[model samples]
Target: MIQKETTGMILRKLRGDRTQEEIAAILGITKSSWAMYERDERVPRDEVKIRIANFFGKTVQELFYTPIEHYKCS
Candidate 1:
């Protein structure tokens, strides 16, 4: 699993004003899956990762490599 800090940043971006359940619905994933992602307990599949990156208007590389701050600037 990746670091919680990374997952936390991803979670914060996905959350917006929605609950985790809401975000999970938007992503077509189970609430438990979303929780696991947030907790850094599991790594999402490539397709799920792509969906998340697309939701945030980010490239996969940005999501996987760049820090949140760097992503914000691009």
Candidate 2:
């Protein structure tokens, strides 16, 4: 099966050479918060998800496809 790319991979590709602070500015969020999302230390809130998708000109699905815990394959 084809594996979906993690949010970090998509973000890294979309952000190109931009720094974390620059991306945070685009999303109107703190750099640490953006870093947390990239590091998978925390999930982004719904509003933040929208901001991320919009900033990168991607649909949320294209940017994030991680299965929730309940949906993980056994």
Candidate 3:
């Protein structure tokens, strides 16, 4: 079974060697805010979620965790 990665893990992996500061700057948020995101201590707003998803060629639904039952959205 494929275990879904946490938002933090997905964010960090997507970041690769890039610094959180640079990514945060690109997203127009503070460095610490970005760190909080990766630590799962905070949830970014939709705008930030969309920006990150676009940057990684993914949808916002794919970026954040979703309950299995929620997948029925058309």
Candidate 4:
């Protein structure tokens, strides 16, 4: 399994203010799939990860490795 940093960012992005279903729709995935991502039970494919990075206006490397303290959505 990957480290929790990625999952943590995702949670920060989705918690309270956003619904899993809404995020899933934005990512072109099913709610259940989004749930898997949230639970850190699965990692998105490379293409999906790229899409997610694009959605957040981040580079894939930044999304995966940048510290949350340094995160910039755009």
lDDT of 4 by residue, 6-54 (tens): 6646655734588888878988989887687777777778898888778
TM-score to true structure, per model:
0.70, 0.77, 0.82, 0.65
Candidate lDDT values, in order: 0.78, 0.83, 0.90, 0.72
- For model 3, what is the alpha-carbon lDDT of residue 24? 92
Global lDDT for candidate 4?
A: 0.72
Which digits, one per residue and each the tens of the lDDT, describe model 2 over residues 1-74? Answer: 76767888778778789999999997899999988888777888888898899877888877777665456688
The candidate scoring highest on TM-score is 3
Question: Which candidate has the highest lDDT of all?
Answer: 3
Q: Is 1 or 3 the stronger prediction by TM-score?
A: 3
Cα-based RMSD of candidate 4:
8.4
| Model 3 per-residue lDDT at 67 | 58
Stretches of candidate 2 exceeding 4 Å from the true structure:
1-4, 66-74
What's the TM for model 4? 0.65
lDDT of 3 by residue, 1-74 (tens): 77877898889999999999999998899999999999989999989999999998998988896657455667
- Candidate number that wins on lDDT, 2 or 3: 3
Q: State the number of backbone clashes in model 2.
A: 0
Q: Order the numbered candidates by TM-score, best leading.
A: 3, 2, 1, 4
